[model samples]
Target: MVYQRARDQAELSAIQEAYHLVSKRMEGVPGLLGNELLRSAHDPSGLVVMSRWSDLAAFQAWEQGSEHRADTAPLRPYQDTRMEIPFGVYEVDAAY
Candidate 1:
């Protein structure tokens, strides 16, 4: 997951735009299942990005690729923290 906080409204707009652009580019990428962009209800400036891939190798390859780096460059400054999981620590035992 990716987490970021914008300093102001303008920064938030930029952040959203950047993520949209990147998400658009991610379309048709092999092994990529889907992605979601979310904002915190309590903290409007906070954001979370989640991406689903077919497997760990697919995610790793994309993470190390130039496109991912380029796409995420604008977001580096606004990022407060990030968490990357290599394996499924928690599984969906029940999804209704």
Candidate 2:
């Protein structure tokens, strides 16, 4: 997942909406999983986005996929991002 910053409330909301809708399109991909978005309590402009995929390849494929490209419709109108940072990637080693 990654954390991105927006310039203001409007931009932050747009990013959140975009991410939410985009994930739905990613549902059937191989190794597909789920994700979450968080706004910093201290700074609401800070967004934390975490996405889980079947694997790195799956994630990469999604990034390069055409469907993923189309999902940008919600964000194209708003150039609302300030900065983005990769928080971390966790591998599913063991789970129930």
Candidate 3:
């Protein structure tokens, strides 16, 4: 997951637009399944971006790629200034 806290409504709009562009880029990525952007009800500026991929290797490849860097550059400012922005990778140990 990725978290964002924009400085204001304008920044939030920009962040959303940047995420839209990044999501578009992810659409054709080799093993990317899909992704969702969720906004916090309590804080309009807070956002959570979650993505799914075919495997850890696939995700890692994308994470380390130049294309990913280019795609997410627009979000760097907000990401850098945000508080409590947590990132992680988890094993899908169980499924319904």
Candidate 4:
């Protein structure tokens, strides 16, 4: 997940637009299951782009690839700088 913070409504709209464009660009990418854009109820400026992959290797492969930075550049400016690490990785340990 990548944390994002928009300074105001205009920036928030831009963030959402960028997220959708990125999502479209990522369609059919190998090992990418899907992704979602989430908003915080308490803090409307807060947002997250959470993506699911088939495995860690798949995600790492994409992250380290040449297109990674270019593909996500649109959203880089809004990354939550307040957090020491604005992103995280996790694997499913259990399922219902």
- Winning candidate number (TM-score): 4
Candidate 3, residue 58: how far the Cα is off, in Å: 0.5
- Stretches > 4 Å off in candidate 4: none
Candidate that beats the other on TM-score, 1 or 4, i.e. the better one:
4
Model 4 C-alpha lDDT per residue in residues 20-39, reported as the tens digit of each score: 88888888878999999999
* Candidate 2 residue lDDT tens string, 18-64: 87776776667666677777778998666766777768888777778
TM-score of 4: 0.95
Model 2 gets an lDDT of 0.68
Best by lDDT: 4
For model 2, the stretches where C-alpha displacement exceeds 4 angstroms are 72-96
What TM-score does candidate 3 get on C-alpha atoms? 0.83
Count clashing pairs, candidate 2.
1
TM per candidate: 0.75, 0.61, 0.83, 0.95
> What lDDT would each prediction earn against the true structure?
0.74, 0.68, 0.79, 0.92
Question: Model 4 misses residue 48 by how many Å?
Answer: 0.4
- The candidates, ranked best first by lDDT, are 4, 3, 1, 2
